[model samples]
Target: MARVLTAKGAATRRRILEGAAELLRRNGTAGVSLELICQTTGSSKSQLFHYFPDGRAELFCAIARFEADRVISDQQPHIEDLSTAESWRAWRAAVIARYVEIGRYCPVNALVVELSRTGPEAEGIVLDMQSRWHTLMTQAVGRLQAAGGGCRHVEPEAAASVVLAAVQGGASIYQATGDFVHLERALDGVLSYVGVA
Candidate 1:
């Protein structure tokens, strides 16, 4: 069974995770080490093992979850309110702006690539995040259809899936080329296909 942490213990664990995440974002997964995490978080080796008994692998999985959450949370109010044409446009802009701000360095993608070959747990975390994101977008597309704003004939789930795929592809292209045009064009093309643009 998992140990039940007191509030203070929980806070300490969160601090370690946040610090590690920052380190990973700045230095990449291969560059981050347990000692560095400890120094950054001001926690001891015992505390690190106390929280992550399985060592670096376990700690990395935790960071993967954190970065996954960041991917969705960073999109904010626009991602959650994607029901209308206006809302969809705003969400698209938010996504573009976020990628532009991050440039070629995506922390979550880095984690995914680093940890995916290690075990199923890391892969599952990323897949779960993607699934949840797709579900949200599917719901939003359904809302647009109900409001008679999007194409009535298009399947919301399929459309959302395509949108997610397009965005992922665009992000990969952006990361490779240092250009946002591909991302913007992909988003605009998907929205137009759904009759939202």
Candidate 2:
């Protein structure tokens, strides 16, 4: 059976997890041993094991989930209420601004790329994040169409895929080359077609 934690234990685990995330952000995946995490977080092996009994795999999965959630949350109210054309534009800007600010230091993308090579748990985290993001964009397209903002001729689902692809492709290029032009143009082109940009 799994161990149930009291509030203090939960807090301790949370601290360790967050500290590890910061360390990963600063150092990437290199030299990130459990011992390093313990030293950085002031956590003992017993405490780390008590929280993450499955060891490094368990902790990495947890970190992936956290990073995946950040991808969605970073888009914020814009993504949530993409009902209006303005909201869609805001969402587009948010997406670009986020990547621009983060530049090549996107740990979520890094974590996804790195951990995905390991196993299903990590792959599933990326899949879930993509699925939810696509669903939201698709739903927003439909709502915008109903509001007479989105192009009536374009299928909401297809349009969502286009924009999602644009964002994803553009982001990958930007993250690789540290250039903003691709992301900006891709988002603008797709968003303009969708009557948002």
Candidate 3:
């Protein structure tokens, strides 16, 4: 059975994860050691082990989940309400602004790239994140269609998938080239297809 943690214990664990995520974002995962995490978080080795008995692998998986949550949480309010053309535009702007601010330091993508080679857990984390994002976007598209903002014939799920793909592709190119043109164009094209442009 899993160990139950007190409120204080849970807070400590969250601190460690947040600290580790900051380190990963700033320096990448190449030189991130348990000692580095301890030093960064001002946490003892025992405390780290108390929360993550399986060590770095387990800790990294937790970090992956944290980053994944951030990916969705960052696009709040706007993503939450996509029933109007204005909301869709706001969401598009929010998405672009977010990537522009984060630049090449995508915590979730970085963690996935580092841990995915080791096993399937990392992949699962990414898949779950993607699935949730797709679902939300699908619902948003459906709302837009119901509101007469989008084409009636365009299926919500399929349109959402394409939009998600476009975002991913745009982010990839943005990271590689330090340019937001691809992301901007992709979003514009996809929104136009759905008649939101």
Candidate 4:
């Protein structure tokens, strides 16, 4: 049976994960080494293996989950409160802030690239993230309709899809070009489509 860790052990494991996350972000997963993580975290080989017996692959999976959680968490209160007009603007601002803060550093994309070498898990993770993103947008649109803010003829689900695609596409472009015009244009386009601009 697997051993349960005490609070100190848990803290140690988290320290190791945080160190590994930084390393993975600075250097692609391939560029990170076990020794580098150990040195950076001051963790022994046994300790590392105690947390991740399967080795680098196990660590990578944990990082993938961490990054995935960050992806959603970064959206924050805006993501959960999209039920209002003010919330919509807040969400837009949050997205812009997050993108600018992160710049070109996309942990989820990096994880996908590294894990793709292993098998279907990478694709599954990507798809799961996408689904969660769509759900957030869809709920926001639904809230707009329930509040009678949406255009009478607009189809909430379809509009939500367009809006999400636009945001993601614009973010991708901004990541490459370092210009936020595309993101702005995409958000504006979505608002315009909804007759809200």
Candidate 5:
């Protein structure tokens, strides 16, 4: 059973998790260590173990979840309100700007890579995040069509899937070759298909 943490204990756990996430983002999974996390967060190994008894596996999974949340929350307001061409364009820009600013050090991707060989949990986390993200976009597409904003002939579910795939492909390209053009072009193509270009 999971331990029930007091408010103070929960806050401490959160502090450690956030600090570790920041370290992971700054250095990638390859460069971060638990000791570094302790030093950076001013937490002891005992505290970390108290919060995450499974040690690195548990802690890494927690970070993956945290980063996954960031992936969606970062695109807020625009992602939530895509009822017009203006909103769609803004959402596109928000997506591009976010990835561009990160410049390939995506903690979510890093954790996925780091934990892929370990087990299925990391993949599950990514899949869950993607599902939630795609659902939100799918709903946004439905909203646009219902509002008579655009995408009249487009299929909401498929369009949203394509948009999500475009982003993944684009981000992969950017991470692989540090090229931004392909991601932008891919997104433009999908947006055009959805009649928002």
Candidate 6:
């Protein structure tokens, strides 16, 4: 069973996670050290160990969850509401802006890389995040379909999965090349494939 933290303890833990996330973003995952996280968070080594008993592995898992939440939350309002064309456009713009804003600083990728040290644990974390992400897209497509925006013949679930995959692929390319064309093309391809072209 997980240990229950007091209110102050929870806050401190959250602060640690946030600090670790920022460090991972500024420096690569391999570049982030426990001493660095503790220094930034103003927490002692004992405190860090108190929260993450498994040392760096526990801290890395927390960071992965943090980045995954960031990915979804950063696309908020648009990701949650897809009942209108405006929402769809808003979501598209939000996605584009997020990638552009991040440039080469992709926290998710960094977390993934660090998590690989733990093998399946890291992979499972990524898979769960992607599943949740795809589910959100599926709901958005369903909303569009209900609003008479999507095509009559396309499968919302399949289309959403494809769109999510395309976005991930595009994001990887964008992170490497600092080019938005691939991302735009991927989004356009998804729409075209769904008969929205």
Instruction: Estimate, for each residue in 94-121, the C-alpha lDDT of model 3 and write its tens digit.
Output: 9888887777766545645664544578
TM-score of candidate 4 relative to the true fold: 0.80
Reference-based lDDT, residue 170, model 6: 81
Model 6 clash pairs are none
Q: How many backbone clashes does candidate 2 have?
A: 0
In the range 54-147, model 4's lDDT, one tens digit per residue, is 8887787777777767878888978776656677777778878887787766555555555445446655666677678778877877777787
lDDT of 1 by residue, 1-197 (tens): 88899999999999999898778766776788999999999999999999999988899889888878877787788777777888888888988888878778665565556655447898888888888888987888888888778888889899988887778788878877888899899999888978889
TM-score winner, 4 or 5: 5
Candidate with better TM-score, 1 vs 5: 1
Predicted candidate 3, C-alpha RMSD: 2.3
Q: What is the C-alpha lDDT of each candidate?
A: 0.83, 0.79, 0.82, 0.76, 0.82, 0.79
Best of the candidates, TM-score: 3
Q: What order do candidates take by TM-score, descending?
A: 3, 2, 1, 5, 6, 4
Kindly report which residue pairs in candidate 4 clash with one another.
none
Against the hidden reference, what TM-scores do the models get? 0.83, 0.84, 0.85, 0.80, 0.82, 0.81
**Clashes in model 5: which pairs?**
none
lDDT by residue for model 5 (23-119), tens:
7766766677889989999999999999988887788788878888888897897989998888989988998899878787665456455644345
Q: How many clashes (backbone N, Cα, C below 3 Å) per candidate?
A: 0, 0, 0, 0, 0, 0
- Lowest summed lDDT window (length 10), candidate 3: 110-119
TM-score, structure 6 vs. true: 0.81
Better candidate by lDDT, 2 or 4: 2
> Candidate 3, after superposition: displacement of residue 100 in Å?
3.8
